[model samples]
Target chain A: MLDKKLLEVLTSPPDAAVAIVTQGKDGPHVVNSWNSYAQITEDDKILFPAGRMNETEQNIQADNRVKITISNREVQGKSIKGTGFLVIGTAEFAAEGADYDTIKAKFPWARAALAIKVESAEQTL
Target chain B: MLDKKLLEVLTSPPDAAVAIVTQGKDGPHVVNSWNSYAQITEDDKILFPAGRMNETEQNIQADNRVKITISNREVQGKSIKGTGFLVIGTAEFAAEGADYDTIKAKFPWARAALAIKVESAEQTL
Candidate 1:
């Protein structure tokens, strides 16, 4: 189960880095962004807005496999330390629907919604 | 080319979080750490000490595809901001030799060295 601590870390301010690894033609390709948005789902899935993700979108479509990590200790002058996590999951895309609408609403530039079905999550020190 | 600004960021104090995403069996696996250690090679590869990374080591050996991100702003009460990067690369393991010895000398607990060969990199906001 996704605990409150994990939720807090995931929902932290935009300063936190979001790293997503995808299989590339040459090797493993990494796409990272200073994340300001991520919606946690009922099934523990994480939904991210896929905006301007030309290569990332293609990589995800080609291979749903992905490893995601969110970690940070700085934001708005407060040090909310001691919480980070690594999530392993399968990614699926949603072009239209309530989920897609919500994501687009949050990030106007969103081209689609990347929904990750959580397989496991581990705490990081 | 790797710039000085990026080097400063990558070599920043341990408050910054290092997130590494690797391909796993179920889908993708994420392994993260506070990362007080990393060696930047002449060819732009990033080396990290792999200690107690049972699953992560396994995953890397299986696929070698990965994405990595490092971001932070608060450490020792100083904020050095405006620098973050995403690196897409291939991962390889080295059990021993000069490269491995160098990593071991830096991190005593490190069992093996995980070297990531840089393929591409992009600045993150």
Candidate 2:
């Protein structure tokens, strides 16, 4: 069963810190701290800026299964943790159309964006 | 497989942001942002402070399964996410013995601590 609080945090809008990891030749290379959000779809996918060509994306291409972890801070000793399965199926240039335009409007520094479909999700304590 | 970088970050010592979510009576109440660490165990379980008697712990008592998300920040557009399954089985007073002593030495403000054992773990992008 998933922790309800964690799910709410992961599914919350605006800004959430995401960690994207892909398999590298040497090992698994990880990029720490990127802004992300969940894409509304039948399968409940997540969308985030992949940015320009980077090692993380290349590793994802090599292996589609990627892990995404998210967290939010709290004042007391409580916090929420959300982990989900991600696979990169499509890539879109930020200069393309409405989707890209919306992303660019929010994050002007993003060059490209990656569309990820979440396969599984779990909450952690 | 877990991302090497993310695993390193989650398993790394010092300071890591953790989110702990448990079931609540009125929907799902969440306490965001707590400091945590991975407990060294034969089963690869991660242990964190439950902190006295709180709503989060109460929810866990009703349902042992809990979710824990850990994350670390980076300068670039990348971050590492670690999510895992947790079950609360034991509670220990910080003044008990070595285990509590160590935790208390590090976290002075903590009252009583709940011990959690992780069952499953995965990485997120």
Per candidate, native contacts kept equal: 0.52, 0.04
TM-score of every candidate relative to the true structure: 0.71, 0.44
Give the per-residue lDDT digits (tens) of candidate 2, residues B77-99. 13423322122233222346555
Q: How would you encode candidate 1's per-residue C-alpha lDDT over A14-105 as one tens digit per residue?
A: 35667777766555556665445787766677888886666767787788777777775643222335556667778877889877887888
Off by over 4 Å in 2: A1-7, A11-16, A34-43, A74-102, B1-125
Looking at model 1, the pairs that clash are none
Q: What TM-score is obtained by chain A of candidate 2? A: 0.63
Number of clashes recorded per candidate: 0, 31
**Top of the candidates by TM-score:** 1
Candidate 1 chain B: worst 10 consecutive residues by lDDT? B73-82
Q: Tens-digit lDDT track for model 1 on B17-125?
A: 6777776665555677654567887777788888777777888878777777766543221233545667778888788976688789988988888888888766665
Query: Any runs in candidate 1 off by more than 4 Å, and if so which?
Result: A24-27, A41-44, A73-83, B21-29, B41-45, B55-67, B72-83, B88-91, B95-98, B117-119
